[model samples]
Target: MTTVGLLYPGHAAEDDFPRIEVMIDSDIRLPLFHTVTDGDSRGVEALRAAGEPERLAAGVEELRMAGAEALIWATTGGSFVRGWDGAHDQVAALARTAGLPASSTSFAFAHAVRELGATRVAVAATYTEDVAPLFAEFLEAADLEVITTESAGIATADEAAACDAERVKELVVAADHPDAQVVLIPDNALRTAAYIPELEERLGKPVLTANQVAVWEGLRLADRRVWAPTLGTLFATREPPPGIDEHRGIEVRE
Candidate 1:
């Protein structure tokens, strides 16, 4: 029974666990921690301070005390605001505070994109358009090309969380680029896992969502890899590196 701790702002998306369950066949516990923001929100402040470092550290400690083998920060915008170096530092600090492996949704996406050997990617975001560049910068730092981006200009966590899945699919389809080999829907606030297989089949490419990559990265931190057709390329083809355990708590693979 591998305990993967998901640190999010509030209650998680109801549909998140089914995808994770499809990967790891064991008793999985999701201990939701309270943060100052709503579950489906997005903003620089929401990402960076919903759970401040002190609070985040405390949350990590709580999960460690509860016997979580690995920790995953389940918000993409949250960890990404700190930029690449800041994101790396946050994961390192959390790992040190919790005494276990740590990873985040942003890092997870980067790893998943690279693991699939995808060099060009199209991104569809349900955030203010301002966030696209930040996301692009983060992905660029990881050496993945951001071929195109589309944002819904949504404001507030509640609205972002309440986004209609059908609309999300439409946005993804609209943002698809001919040159892009992969499409990334980088927001946990939107329900993406449930539609990945169908979307991939239609696009003839990989489609990765925030929650899917976050869970995948958490499992990888535990030295696990899963091949679920529903997860698209990240799960279908990612290979874990040797001795990854030594760096799981700090550095992320690129």
Candidate 2:
């Protein structure tokens, strides 16, 4: 079985590990590390520390020991809050430290959108409205256009995890614009694996959710593109990518 390592935030993203495994019939192994964090006001320290190079290197080592062929820093805010350059450097440090292929959910979202041939996107985010703009800016920096954004104003990881798919769908469809080519839900805390199909069908466009794209990114790193379809058009549609260089990171594909 192909093994994918994930540095998931403590108190967040617990269900995603199983969601990916169950959603795909690839028989892959997901080894998770509950990353060290202290949730404080605005989660400033927690997010910053999660991307710290020294700390991330250690996380990569732990996953390496578990035989993970690829790694993902699976939190959205922890990566994007740093902006594009910082997010790129964070994954570079992980790849360098572990001497393995690496990617982050932030880049995964951007890469997924680019793979779908979309320029304009609508975002439904679980971050506080104040912080949601950072994600929009991150996407813009990655060269995607932001058409609309809706934030649920959720501040805590636990609350974000507690969000059901139906509520999330409501937020997503509400945020979608007539001209948007895709709808993105940008909170790793959410359990979005099972909702992508219905959401996409309803929106008449692609829906890229945090947990779904995060798993897809890791699987792509492991070179397991056609793992059998479950939800979303991605599983049914994406062809094997030209390999991502372990040193160069994921390509901003055409």
Candidate 3:
């Protein structure tokens, strides 16, 4: 069976792995590795622990030992809290160490938007108010326009995952801008993995959530991307833009 690696934070958000496995069907395996994280909160200590190069390498190496074919740094804030350049460096380091294609949730979000050809986006961030703006900068750096953003002011990963889907969808709608062509929920802790279709139906536009995109990016790197009607727009094939080469998928350049 095909296997992909997930380098997750050391928090209590337990829905990710099982949800991803179900989303991918029984055809693939997800080797989960937890990188150090001091708390479920998104603070300096949490960021340092989650994104530290040496610790991250340890997790990647562990996944490599598990025979993973590709790697995903599945923590959104962990990757984006460092600036755009730092995020790029973080994923590059992982791919070099793992000797396989790799991506972080931050880059996965960007690539999913580009692949969907949606330039104007609304962000429903599940971070604290102070922490949410950083993702706006990250998206801008990725060349996508953030029409608007809203934060749920959630303090921890566990909190975000346990947040009800209706509430999350409410935040997504509140975050929506008149120009928004797509809505993005940028938190791997979030449990919107199964609600993609319903969310899109309510908003009348594509909704891309963190875990959903991470799975897509994982399959993408493994050259296993195929149509999955349940994954909403990110799984649907679209024409690549002028410069991107989709078959190779998400190169961070080691």
Q: Please give the CA lDDT of all the candidate structures.
A: 0.75, 0.79, 0.81
Q: Write model 2 residue lDDT over 99-148, tens digit each, in one string.
A: 77889988888888876666799999878877889999999998789999
| Model 3 lDDT, residue 180, Cα | 96
Q: Tell me each candidate's TM-score.
A: 0.88, 0.90, 0.91
Find the 10 residues in a row with the least total lDDT in model 1: 245-254
Model 1, global lDDT? 0.75
- Candidate 1 regions exceeding 4 Å error are 12-15, 22-31, 38-41, 238-254
**RMSD for each of the candidates:** 3.7, 3.8, 2.3
Give lDDT for model 3. 0.81
Scanning candidate 2 in windows of ten residues, the lowest lDDT window is 245-254
lDDT string, candidate 1, 160-241, tens digits:
6677767877888988999998999888776667778888888888899998888877777877666676666677765544
